[model samples]
Target chain A: MLTPLKEFATDIRIQQMEEFKARGFGHVGGSLSITDCLAALYGGIMRIDPKNPNWEDRDRLVVSKGHSGPALYAALALKGYFPLETLKTLNQNGTTLPSHCDRNLTPGVDMTTGSLGQGASTACGMALGLKLSGKDSRVYLILGDGECQEGQVWEMALFAAQHKLGNFIAFLDYNKRQLDGYVTDICDLEDPAAKFESFNWYVKRIKGDDPDKIYETILETQKNQKDRPAMIVLDTVKGGGVKQIEDTTLNHHLNMTTELADEIIKQLIKQKEG
Target chain B: MFKCIYNGEKETKAGKTVFGETIRKMIEEDPQVVYLDADLMNSIGTSGLEKSFPNQVIEVGIQEANMAGLSGGLSAVGKKPFMHTFASFAGRRCYDQVFISIAYAKNNVRVIGSDPGITSAYNGGTHMPFEDICLYRAIPHSTVIEFTDSAMTAALLPVIKERPGLTYCRLSRKNCIAIYSEDSVFEPGVANILRDGKDAVIFACGYMVSESLKAAETLEKEGISTAVVDMFTIKPLDTAKVLEFAEKTGAVVTAENGNVVGGLGAAVAGFLSETRPTPVIRVGVKDEFGQVGTPEYLAGVYGLTPADVVAAVKKSISLKK
Candidate 1:
């Protein structure tokens, strides 16, 4: 049985696929993999006002793995940040929805992020700024497992730990695949959780496909009294929620035709109806 | 209208001292101003910030890139962040972060890159940055500035804080020959004419401003009346002032402590060639790396002495039609 949030996530995935189909090509694999987390964050967890996206006290969500912007845009559109029809203009000329997240162009984007590993450091900055201003607003960052290979990520990790940024929470979308190949084959981040643990972050691992588990873990991490930044390693498949592309090895970015996209959308609609 | 007083150097102060004092005052006045350093608190004279404003000062240890990104994040949330480090690390080491995180995101970050160019004496080429200005000038909407002296550093600190965009402040950490009075007002993108002469004009920034003044004094003894303009703001180059001076003098010499290939000399030459043609001579370091030595030794070795500027001035005059 699908939970209410899970059903919402399915709707987001459907929209994301439709947008990609309209564009003809996009980062379909990573985008689909992160939909459940985005659903949970936008649906329930993050304290954001879609109407007044620049509310000073609202919590911030910086998607560090910004190639997955299609999924993030779907969530933002579905939540009324913009009209749902705008999703069709994903990568069209003069479209506000670029392949990566641009804060100035996008209505609800907190920070512009396309370059990998930079968003992590910026998230730490936001958290630090919030704490310095005596605001209790939290900051959430979503990073790719492959994005962790950048040295700046570790630099931010050390800074976040040293500052004891209790309000900063990061989610590593460990989809196990990158643009080139599987992360293990390219450069394995063996014992990824251990790395964050050593950096003094409160670490947790969960199945990313489950909205309930993600929600519960975030609540539990927030309740902890320890004054340290938190990291939740999301164990997710590369093309999660859809079985066809989930098993494909080289689906990091899809060169999809309209036929393939239509087939994926059909399956998603059937799953939602069932 | 600015006067260069040589004999009575009464108001001279170290660049780091003025920087520290000015930042301290700004922090005390504005609750939104925050300071971050890459473990160079004592080196850059901002060590007291940690003690006074504990929450506002962050010492991100030995991580320049992270410091820049963090500054961007703070700016996003309405905190005016001022970050300081050596010039090389501030420009070359963290160029990407400064580009995407700060400039591209449209966040207001004031980066203070102390000990620019040959001023990184004893630290050698490993710490020296001859291309800092060139790197910053390429970024669209970036305001690149090099402080002429302690007074200029003190005057521009608050102005840069309020400016809404990416700003790079290049200043020496040690004492500088003070050029302006304590109350001298400064506006960005405006050049200040220190000395006026019809024979030749000298454009200089950072430590070279003092050198150019000394060269002017030497040229005056030889009956060669020279003009000196403190071209502090490098990007958004004061094209009007540059063209006016070039038209007035008919000959130009650019002196800097950085590489002539892309530093002040290149900027002036490129601008002049496009709009107004003039006989221009560049007096700065040739294509070479810095070496471990005293500032005086390195200045002489790199052909950055007052005598070199005097020679370049003569050459520019001779080339004039």
Candidate 2:
């Protein structure tokens, strides 16, 4: 069971790398950065039927950091949202998987998001709205560490905490990297978990690459209610899977060659075996 | 547009702007109209709504951004949400929330931004957003509108309800010049041709419709036939009508209550400059900040009065050669 699960996630990451390699350069840093988080959610946690996307009671997963489309698309394909072959057309001119996630175009995309710092707020609305209509549908939003600089994010955090939207689960890809450089050098997001807690949110931190921890945390989040919004800070490495692509100065977006893609695929295959 | 002579005032009614009233009616008639206020229910005339539908209304208390987000949520799951707040707060304060939460997500929510432009009165510069139109125009798929009067509001009410997308309407707190009568016409995407002429096109929107009409009258006195078009939908601007006027007239002038930048002028200029290179003069607040004064005084201060519209028309006519 463990071998197959790990293989499935690894295959998803390998496919993501291949697509980026096709484009020659995509948001490699952020895309690779979010693969495991997407793997865990779509793999085992989220109760989403790829065949029935508008399933009224289906849980929602919002990719607030839309630049990480490759990762989410890889996850969606593996989860049977669309044929796994469609993953190759990640950023084509007329493809469903745009550089940013668009609900209008993609079959299972719950919402369209390109502008940073607004997706989390909408997730709060989605979760709260579901609860209001007497449905138990949960919403999960993955926020970029770089996006925390936006003042609107805090406003939403304070709001979610104040409203005690327990049905909403927020994940912070605390990879310590952004578009330009490290998050601290860009703008210090000192202690995100503590910041959320201070804003009256029930926040927990986990190693973003650890599937077991991510899966367990997802279960832990289900118990939240009537107190504060839940936030899981996934402490991750930028450019997660491929070791070579992992910690560049610009740890957010990456431009790589076919040579790098081949080496990354080799590493993943070896990692799958070892 | 219809005009009623009330005490010889000759007021044109846009529609009865009863955002608070409509929500109350919806709550009583149907339990789905969820009214959310940013704690400005009394200020924005939502107090009566709260009394009628206390359970439906959520007073999120001073959190405009959150209120915007929450309202979008309420709308997503079959709850008709009317988020009432000041124009400045709704447009600028929670801009991202409106763009992503409501519009991008395709949530059925109505955003009523009261005290648009100089109408904020003594609330000063920070409150009165002379640039709200420009800010909202940046968001794609957003229904940005300004009711010429309460009649326009009432006419617009039923239309906004049936509309599936996100909508933002600016309501005048104090009564100004009404654009239509009690039972009149109101269309969101379609631009209303108040007056059509051949000499030049006078494209205007929001509070400036009356000013543009007066400006057309002023231009007519000078023997220049000016056509007046109320461009209510700034985003999907009525380019068909505007280009026709430009082709027939050879010159055009766009007047709006907001900044000359991304408001009606920018939209028209962007269209005609590429489609039909006709001479266009844009009369609006010249890329500057707002100031503390009365609405009437601020109009003059920002060059948004009838005089400015007339001057813009004359200048655009000169550029025709």
- What lDDT score is found at residue A272 in candidate 1? 77
- Each prediction's RMSD over C-alphas, in Å, is 1.4, 3.9
> Mind giving the per-residue lDDT tens digits that candidate 2 earns over A1-274?
3455567679878988878878777888888777777777877788888899888889888888988888888877777789878877878889988899887778888777768877776677778777666677888899999898987688788778766687888899999988877789879999999999888887789889877678788787777534567889999988886677774666566676889888988888888878
TM-score of each: 0.98, 0.85
Provide the lDDT at A128 for model 1. 96
Determine the iRMS, in angstroms, of model 1.
0.5
Q: Model 2, B1-321: lDDT tens per residue?
A: 444322213344212235556556666776676778887877756676555555577777787877877776667656788887888888888887888778877888888888877767798888877778877878777778877666677667667876787887877766667566678776787788888798888888777888888888889998999998888777678889988899989989998877788888998999999998988899888888777888789998889899998898888888987
Pull out the clashing pairs in model 1.
Answer: B14-B175
Pick the DockQ winner: 1
Q: Candidate 1, overall lDDT?
A: 0.90
